[model samples]
Target: MPLAEIPLCVWRKRGQDFVFQGQAIRYWVAGQGEPLLLIHGFPTASWDWHYLWQPLAQRYRVIACDMLGFGDSAKPLNHAYSLLEQADLQQALLAHLGVDQPLHLLAHDYGDSVAQELLARHYEAGVEIASCVFLNGGLFPETHRPVLTQKLLLSPLGWMIGRAFSREGLVKSFRQIFGPHTRPSESELDDFWSLIDSHHGPRIMHKLIGYIPERRVQRERWVSAMQRGDIALRVIDGEVDPISGGHMVERYRQLIPSPDTVLLPGIGHYPQIEAPMQVLTHYLTFRDDLVSPPRKAACS
Candidate 1:
């Protein structure tokens, strides 16, 4: 594929490499300041942040990695792709980099689950964390509405279905989740498929999709971490996403005390991609508010 045709060409050139637990991990680091670790959702790599990478890197020390079984990372057929292990890998990655500064987290889809485990660790083992921002994901299993492809991928014939998946299938599936009006462009679809095709991603998608079920099993611990409310947390979602959009936000507001959220009315699941400026503005506002919270008036 021509570099001009695939946007990932530049992202590939700019990214650095790391080895985690004997597995090759693709991660990127840029800028300087407080560390902001980005965890991308399933079926896509850290490239998901490509839209917001430079602007974010301009301010914060940004770290993003392609988790195991996704993107440029090695996708092993034997390993069980679980969120717990993914969280462990993230911690190890930061630790390996000697990132001791208080860290902020930005996660989407599967990354959200891993972030939840990290949040739990903050309470359990005292990992320094300042805040966490969640994108559209199956955070609550009940609220997650997987499209037909995902359901089929999780079925008994999942492995077969995943292996036989095609580019047309990918486009069809994405169209369902993304807002009707904000559908992915041809180039965007090309990038997504190309990334998935890297390292036999399609072959192992079933294993990765298992996170949905894993979320239900570990619900007690992960959900408790959110309910604990120890650190600053916020949610930015695309309201039209069929999977985890407005519906998920409603559930979040109901569950988390004093919830802070932003809903992009016409947007869908991938808010960062669909509306980078909007997501960036809202995200910066959330980060800024943390630094200088609005003060209350003194009693007369």
Candidate 2:
């Protein structure tokens, strides 16, 4: 399977679009219905949803974008890829698309951080949020254990490593992130590498880590916002994920009362890629549960 032939059936390269900040933002949109925004994590493009797009697009308006410094999106070296900046860009993208309606947010990894910031702002503004589905990722920095690569990238040594990122290194990093999951097929690995091989790719990697602030300061606020009951929240965690394991799930449940949490055994971090069918099924179940008619009050 050559990298080009990996079958990105759902996401098409729709090209660039002008928004408030600049024209550097690029995104792909597919399907139709209540808007469903899929935000990818650090070091990966919207292609993270390659396996997830088609099935999800079939039922909902799926929009996946390369964050400012990643994928086809323009990378401005001078700009800071902070969480607040990313959230603002995402909001602008949605507003540009005329998706004023409440949205269902599906995010993983660093995306979870960005989405948290976005939802927090929205919650403060009293905006409607259809639902939020968080996959394997560290939402709270305090609870997050940074991997060796993450620690290096956030350190002064990051520039050197960023500059040294090679195809070999990229593949190795991908494998490490996948942890116990079977090695991605050569072609799949190549596809991921090619995307990161783009200009300033390594530099963007460095910036992404800097984007997340110390979570201790904001953790309680995020937890409180999610528990507000007005917004529906659920989590689908990869049981074996090294970065965000069952411990993170317990923390989430503790903070957000009655959070719907699903543990996928045998799956690692990237559930969307590793278990597309299962991920889709859970998403559909969540969606249906939302629209299902509430049972009449039990006879008093």
Candidate 3:
């Protein structure tokens, strides 16, 4: 589907109300049954899940929203979009959705960081998590090597750089996220650019990058909690993604015992866009595994 063809206006108009840290949030809700919340990464909005949503929604209550500053959601300049704040916002959104039972979480890029904070908070509150599917990001800042653009955006002078850049520069920056097998079509690129062209795009971009917390002692604590037997964590990684490929998977494996990892060859950072089929397959298999009966113990 083309970007221009997307019913973003209609979706925004129909969004349900939610409160995030004293601010109101607008989110899209569709389907029914076990809840499945999909969170997008930087620059883009919930539209990132456009392809995967329909199929997934057929069997799950799909919820995808534009994180505070992105898409048609409320963009409050007063609030700093920190990871902690985003997590709290997601928590409030869930409460508004009446999602009290354990549910699956699908997160990519920065969304993973937000999920980490939510999972940590839930664990502390003794809440149950059915499963978590992490794609392309694990929030291990110590191990992450940000690209030059990332560094620029996260720096103090990000606002100037973002405001001064051209459309070609924006396209070039986005190209870095794809793999050799997947070059985003012109329409897709235009859609991304349009979203970034939205109000306070540059400022929001800067805050998004700047707000990521540095890896600290808490990393070990969160990793330990995620490793607990009760939580089923799986990772779907794009092999060609320089940002969070093999090394990130290795780190996750070392920290979390028996994490189900799938490597997609010839695909890069955005697996949902580059390799949607692979992503969908992995998600379905993981979901089935969670619902399926466990193998009987071997007889003595």
Best by TM-score: 1
Native-structure RMSD, model 3: 4.3
Q: What's each prediction's clash count?
A: 0, 0, 0
**Ten-residue stretch with the least lDDT total in model 1:** 291-300
What's the ranking of the predictions by lDDT, best on top? 1, 2, 3
As for TM-score, the candidate ahead, 2 or 3, is: 2
Q: How does residue 71 of candidate 1 score in lDDT?
A: 91
What is the C-alpha lDDT profile of model 3 across 162-257, one tens digit per residue? Answer: 666555866777678679769788777767766666665655566667545543545766666677757777788887788887788778767766
Residue 240's lDDT in candidate 2: 72
Off by over 4 Å in 2: 1-12, 214-217, 293-300
What's the distance in Å from true for residue 107, model 2?
0.5
List model 1 lDDT by residue over 168-232, tens digit each.
99898888888778788898898888989997888898898999889999988888889986688
State the lDDT of candidate 2 residue by residue for 156-181, as single tens digits: 88878777777788666666656376
Question: What is residue 83's positional error in candidate 2, in angstroms?
Answer: 1.1
Query: Per-residue lDDT for 130 in model 1?
Result: 88
